[model samples]
Target: MFNVYITKAGKYLPNEAVSNDEMEGILGMINDTASKARRIVLRNNGITSRYYAIKDGIITHNNAQLTHLAIEQLYDSRFTKNDVELLSCGTSSPDNLFPSHAAMVHGLMDNRSLELNSSSGVCCAGMNALKYGFLSVKSGNTSNAVCTGSERSSTWMLADKFNNEVINLKNLEEQPIIAFKKDFLRWMLSDGAGALLLENEPAGDISLKIEWMESFSYAHELEACMYAGGDKMDDGNIKPWQDYQAEEWLKQSVFAVKQDVKLLEKYVLKLGAKSTKIALDKHGVSDSDIDYLLPHVSSNFFATRLYDALLEEGIDLPNDKWFMNLSTVGNVGSASIYLMVEEIMASRKLKKGQKLLLIVPESGRFTYSIAYLTVC
Candidate 1:
């Protein structure tokens, strides 16, 4: 089997920062009951702070701009545009109905040799794209690839529609807003972009080499979370409210994680990599055996639940092995796993010869992906 390595990685966030308190104030300006609005913000999502694109200190940037900036940060003039073999953008937000975000990124790069593709698998686009890209590289179809996942949820958020749903200020004061409007708005929304460059050989500072990649889909639960039929103004808006129900998604997510672990166990056993007992042993030496762990950043709640599930499986891993920065960056959909890998490498924690395990759970259903990496 051929080895696929991550040559470089980059992340970009809008200049303006929005804390929970500021968000509450903004919500209050549009809603009558400011206190109730604040509570709504606190209870629904565990997000404390998230980055936003800004125009003159105001939070706003379209998908095109975010994609361009993220790529620029990743490329950093190290390679010319023509050097790129594949340019893929995994995003829920595209600037237009046609041309696709991948085409837009290609134009931004101004390179003629780049082949472009776009994916819209919600938050899982990042991991799914990587799996596809690795296959392309292993098949000798491409030697270099760039994968980017970007979103500008703030632009799509309809604040006016949200405030109008508040029927009675007194009613809100007495009870929680049962309106689907506010809850949906808070749930399936976040903004940021992450880009990664993959090559057959190590480039600059090598992060980790890709040893294996796999993906599973649970199409039966597709309707568990979905968005359909909206104009350009409301483009990419998800619906049915149940999509943002974290508790419901958690059950399916855990099932996916266990399934992926079983698959990984099979892969490792086939390759004679490690015995089942060694892999699941409670000893802290598992860290010495496998250098790092990068799990999907679905949410803080999801991360905690996944960690607990791993413990139940007899996989003892310290908090230090987990690369979780969602509290600082929020969830960048598919970009979350790759971004976590970048964070771990940049922190100078990963040493040579150590193995890293990458895990991602797709939202809305019980599907997951697992990949193993070794530091080169």
Candidate 2:
């Protein structure tokens, strides 16, 4: 069996930072009620801060641009563009609805010696891409692979429509100005990018090796969360809307998580590793076994739900460790898990020989992917 190791990982956020109070100021001018609602919404979601791209930025800093930057940063000076045997990009936004983002990244990197693949199955794209890349390496078809996810929620956000319809539904006549301010923009959304470089280690530095990857899709729960193109108004501006049934979305997400945990248990058994044995395995050795978890940042509520479930299964975790970054990052779609990995590594908290568990829960036709990694 080929052992696929993560060589490097990196993430980039836009230069500007948006805070909650600023968002309220922007909303206050448009509709005081909407501003109040926005505060409640953000508070409920547990998102205090996020990043956005500047208007004059070279790259749009959307999903594709973020992914590109991440890959470039991770592989800096270590490998030439041609050393990459495959490139995979996962995102909800397509470059134009025709050409895939993978092709765009490949062209940007001047990578001419690899097959390119793209994934767009909503939030699960990143995990799916990683699994696909791992399979390619395990099958001996590729030696080096790059998987990336970039998201710019700001560009896709229709501030006027979002604020008007969702927040100030009762008194639209009171606030008429389309006030677009930093505060409102901050609460509206943020952008970020993350990438991982994987390779088949013949005998060199191996950061983390993938032990197993599993995915389960629950198709019966489609439409639990959705996005629809909006009708053009007389003013000629296009709008978009979210179709979310919060209660049902939560149900499916929980189900998916349950299934994912079961599969993870089975994989651990296959590897001769049990939940109880994780702690006693090793100390500081390069391959000493430790449980390092990286789960998808779905929502504050869902994160807690998963935590409870893990606790029920006797999976002990340090307080505030598993879902630490979700409150700040929000739901980053496919980029959440990878970005969590980046955050954990940056903190210098993970020791060698630790086991990292990555769980990704995607909405709408809910799908869950679980990956096991051993820190090297």
Candidate 3:
């Protein structure tokens, strides 16, 4: 198989940065009351500023538009839109359910028709798209491909979306706030897009040589931990959005993102470390092989916990060797790892032969995606 290299990386972080004090204003306050969980969530996530595609409840860029903008920035003298043979896009918060996210993104580009692949998942969706592009080029099916991971999370975080749920809870004489499962995510997610251009040859003075990409799913052993478009039943089964009546949709807030925090606390880090150890062992990669570690963490609350988990697995990488951008960019779901890569590449801090390990944990179903890339 031919080797695939990341020729360039680009990102688009919607409008100006929105500060912590401004988030509720933009997303609006549910029931005209401040979110009891917002400050606590933000404090733990450690995100001071984040961008949004919406301003004053108006969307400036849909998910497709954000993805398209990031892709447009990938073109240069060595690569143009016409040179793209494949377009793969991934997102959990897509604009529509009918047209695939990749299709919608491809529609925005003024280029010839090309093969499209859209990956559907939470955080790992981005890596899945990257893996698809990497393999497409490695297999010689395409000489070049563009892959993107993006999220327009603000669209779903709007307070109005939860109004019905709050009202329903009030009528039931329960605490008026939405469940912590759904309300906490409002302060954790951000809107942004990041893209990678892959080709048979490396571009510029430095490029990332895709060594190997591996993914693990513990779904067989674990129940869903994070989800949307469905309601979690008491039996731990997910009742899909389509299964509910239209009125029940708004009443239950079935479409709003939610997480089983207890499940996340129990399995997220443990499964991630387990999967990472397995990947490293399968490839004969040791802790010393990793020059830099890029991990996509949903909240900084898990940062030190993640380090400890990795140590338990015998991967002894230090804190300094780790690279993260969550504080500045917030958690962009599938785009988080891509954004981390984009900034690191732009920093020009990597040296030849240096190895970077990217770990993305998806609480959606205890999935983990680990990839190794070498600077060349």
Give the winner by lDDT: 1 or 3.
3
The models' CA-based lDDT, in order, is 0.60, 0.60, 0.93
lDDT of 3 by residue, 1-376 (tens): 9999998999999989999999999998998998899989998989988999987667899999999999989988868899899999999988999689999998899899899999999999999999999999999999998999999999799999999988888889987778889889999999999999999988898899999999999999888999999988898899999999999899889999999999999999999999999999999999998999999999999999999999999999899999998888899999999899999999989999999999999999999999999999
Candidate 1's TM-score reads: 0.75
lDDT by residue (tens digit), candidate 1, 251-288 = 22211111122322223222212222233342333445
Model 1 residue 225 CA deviation (Å) reads 3.3
Off by over 4 Å in 2: 24-33, 55-60, 160-189, 202-206, 221-223, 230-290, 313-323
Please provide TM-scores, in order, for all candidate models, with all chains considered together: 0.75, 0.72, 0.98
Best by TM-score: 3
**Candidate 3: worst 10 consecutive residues by lDDT?**
174-183
Candidates ranked, most accurate by TM-score first: 3, 1, 2
- Model 2: per-residue lDDT, tens digit, 4-111? 988778888766555766544432333333444466557656777766654442434555667777887776566766678888788765555667888877767765
> How far does residue 226 in candidate 2 sit from its true spot (Å)?
3.4
Task: Judging by TM-score, tell me the better candidate of 1 and 2.
Answer: 1
